[model samples]
Target: MSRKRLYLRAGLYAEGRSDYDFLLPLLNRLLSSLASSLFPGACDVEDSLGIDAPYPAPSERAERIAAAIADRRAECTLFVIHADGAGDPRYARQSCLDPGIDAARRASPDVVTVPCVPVRETEAWLLVDAEVFRPWLGSDAHSALPAEPEREADPKLTLGRLLKVKEGRMRRKPERLYRLFGEEVSLEALRALPAFQLFEAELVEAIRAVARSQGWPR
Candidate 1:
């Protein structure tokens, strides 16, 4: 049986971390779980961001990622997932998603660019496989990390019904208060919040769509 190699790029902020650190693990868990659950012999997914190199420009980033996909030398598909609408000059001046898709198509024409709905919405994608990652929170998931939150309330209140309860009850919901709290909240915020369940479901469906398009190996 010929094995296809799948390559993924986690984008700029994810550079120096091990797969166990951040988004990589979340994505890996989803893909591996899906593959194991549905297809025992599907293509093996590998991340090439481990190359220990400087961050490339948008086009260069696409090229470098494309080169890695090409080097796999197997019938494969490459998916590049990134955060869009970050107010980055490059993404604003030129379409990062389009160029990436074009670059990957240069190799397989099947390459996919799965940009987050928006920069802020990236929290949704990062948390797509969060259920499997709660253990990493260690002890209290709420206090996994401490910050000087602008709001006096426990930051975890941002999670779901609590958010409504806290903000809705506030006599004066300060704009700065909400914005500052948002900055401190991690991707875990989405996982713990009920409002984002739909986003998480969308990510799972998108991933499954890609996998299915690739022809899941039975």
Candidate 2:
């Protein structure tokens, strides 16, 4: 009997450059967990294509998605698109993610696309786990976090207030802070958020679709 080998290649189009620092690690962790459960005993390899530049205008998103698909259609099995649900989650999904994903699917029907639209902003997701702040703020980290952080109008501002540093002390850069939060934040807490739950469900379905198409053992 031969052991099966599975290669999972993912492409990420983040809304901001700082998002990569957080999302890359978060996505990798999710993939690792999924692979362990879904393809136990198989040799699983993972790769990712990161889009680090500024997001294109909404009008250009479809063309950009199609071009990205064309560029790595052979290697990429999944594409995760990030769009901040600022003010209106519905509008963001319709205007920012749906059209692009539809166009991409039309061009490369085999590839699976997942939308990651964090309510308000990605910072909202980081606010769910208060323990993630202890390392930076010590006992003073006991500030009250929002009950429903996703509904907060400006989660970034709220996070900044909670993590404020004293004058003359150097503050951690946003990218590094986001990466730290990503690595340490509890996934269980994240799942409590409606937006995160939706994203995770879609991601799981996308992975299952890819696995079925590839005939990889479940």
Candidate 3:
């Protein structure tokens, strides 16, 4: 029998430019991890941001998803959309993500869609592991980190304050910090979060579907 190698290509539709910086690396890692677990043989995972096409208006989320699918359908096996829960995870999923996913699938039947709705904001997920950013804080700053970041009304603001303290009056840009968090934050800590777990489950199912279609044994 000829050896089979699985090659997975993923595309991302991030909510913001900074979101791409964070989510691209994070998605790549997550997909690689999941692919390795599901495929015993050699596996390769590659990802790209769906930036070839312009996004529609923020309110036209379903259109945006359809556009992304149209743009990357040929090159990508899976498409992940990142949307901040913005204080109401259920509403975000029901009002924004589900409609978008449905439209994308309807428009491009071959496209595999995955929703990544981080509760409150993507920053909340970054806070899952304080150790990732603790070293950047000043010694005098002694404020306790939020015990439940998803419940925090504005995790981005909280993270901004910490980064400001670390950089003093210079006002550090958060994009680098987000990238750092994406690279180093512990997957175990993220898995403990309900929102992350939901994403993982959906992502795994999508990958399984792709594998089945490709005639790969799961």
Question: Which residue runs does candidate 3 get wrong by more than 4 Å?
Answer: 55-59, 138-143, 166-172
Query: Judged by TM-score, which candidate is best?
Result: 2
What are the per-residue Cα lDDT tens digits for candidate 1 across 1-218?
86764332333222223221434444554445444554456446554232222344334655654554454425333343443334342463256445544665687765444433233323222333323234343344444332322221322233322223343553224443233333333445445543234435545554555666656432
My TM-score estimates for the predictions, one after another, are 0.42, 0.89, 0.88
As for lDDT, the candidate ahead, 2 or 3, is 2
lDDT of 2 by residue, 72-108 (tens): 6766778898899996877999998898888877877
By lDDT, rank the candidates, best first.
2, 3, 1
The whole-model lDDT of each prediction reads: 0.40, 0.79, 0.78
The candidates, ranked best first by TM-score, are 2, 3, 1
Model 2 scores worst on lDDT over the 10 consecutive residues at 50-59
Consecutive 10-residue window with the lowest summed lDDT within model 1: 11-20
The clash tally of candidate 1 reads 0
Q: Ten consecutive residues with minimal summed lDDT in candidate 3?
A: 164-173
